[model samples]
Target: MSQPVIALFTDFGVSDPYVGQMHARLVAEAPQARIVDLHHYAPAFSPGPAGLLLEALVPHLTPGSVVVGVVDPGVGTARGSLALATDEHWFVGPDNGLFASVLEAREGRCFRLREPEGDGLSVSFHGRDLFGPAAAALARGDRMVLGEEVAEPVRAEARRDAVLYVDHYGNLMTGLVPPEDGGARLRVEGRNIPFARTFGEVGPGELFWYRNSLDRVEIAAREGSAAKRLGAGTGTAVAWIGGV
Candidate 1:
């Protein structure tokens, strides 16, 4: 049998120890599972945009892999935990609209993560204490940790006409899919960005939008940062220029 895969996606920046603790917990509970770091910088404290970005990533992952998502800002609150079982992957995370895009992508079974009877888990770090362990258990084919089935998770708050993420290179990834025509343009931050097949298609230091690897519209500036150029970031409103 193929090895079990547990991919990690979070807004926990690398400068902190939060992600490391999750890795430690996963390794301890699911040693047989291989861990993949999908991403660690996903628009801090913004799960709606992160969920949209994650939805774009679902098709690229290996079948039946487990994804541990920790973009939760309401970690210690009354907000609940969720386990989303899709045909292509399993997602474990908070119920704060993190899995909304994924849930809307297809039919899936949702389960509430059961709480531990003891008070050992940390309130502020559910990523390591709750989600990590749940992912490990799911990786090991154990669903006992999941509680009741959830009929409807929160709806995705990330709109397709908005910027979902801004990468380190300043590329702006939007939830909107690009059209086949290279002539199609996108408007954001009161600026119009033309389409290009790639960075080389445009002159150096030029700004353009293209269908990114993840099949989403990405705005980039060759030899420069698009975010800086357009003064845009997550939640920036994006609009179609030519009805595409």
Candidate 2:
């Protein structure tokens, strides 16, 4: 059998030791696995928007990969940890709606993670102490250790008309999918942004909307920051206009 690929998605930024510690644990636990740093700055502490971004990103991941997602705002409390087996990938994370869109789009089985038996599992750092190890185990094909299967996992309402993420270039990636026909426009913050094939199609610093590689409608400003130009950020409302 081919070795499983492990993808890490989290709100733990690169500057901190949290991500490094998770990487170290995965290395120790699942030495043979290939780890992919999918995203580290996933709209901090907000799983609903994070889940939408994950859903848009799912198509770009390697098939059969194991995704370790952590966007838990209620980590140390009574919230549960989960392991989800989708049709083509396995996702390990907190059951705080981070995997909601993934579950909604794919056929999957959800399991509550079994707590660590004797290890020093920290209350605040479950991403390193708990989820990372569980993801590694899943990547190594050890399903038995993930605890009882749950019938339903928590789900957040998928928002289709909201900006899910803002890229480094300040492009606003909305949850709404692009229209099938070409000439669609996006209305945001009282501005009607026209559609463009690419950046060059519009004048520099001009705001426009396009279908991103992920097939989501994205608002961008050619050679500029759309987020600033439109005064928008994550969770900002966007409306579609004039498309077939």
**Local accuracy of candidate 1 as per-residue lDDT tens digits, 57-149:** 988887778999989888888998999998778999999899998888798999999876698689899988898899999899888999999
What's the lDDT of the predicted structure labeled candidate 1?
0.89
Off by over 4 Å in 1: none
lDDT of candidates 1 onward, in order: 0.89, 0.89
Candidate 1 has a TM-score of 0.96
- Reference-based TM-score of each model: 0.96, 0.96
Which regions of candidate 2 deviate over 4 angstroms?
242-244
What local lDDT score does residue 60 receive in model 2, on the 0 to 100 scale?
96
Clashing pairs in 2: none
* Residue-pair clashes, model 1: 0
RMSD of 2: 1.3
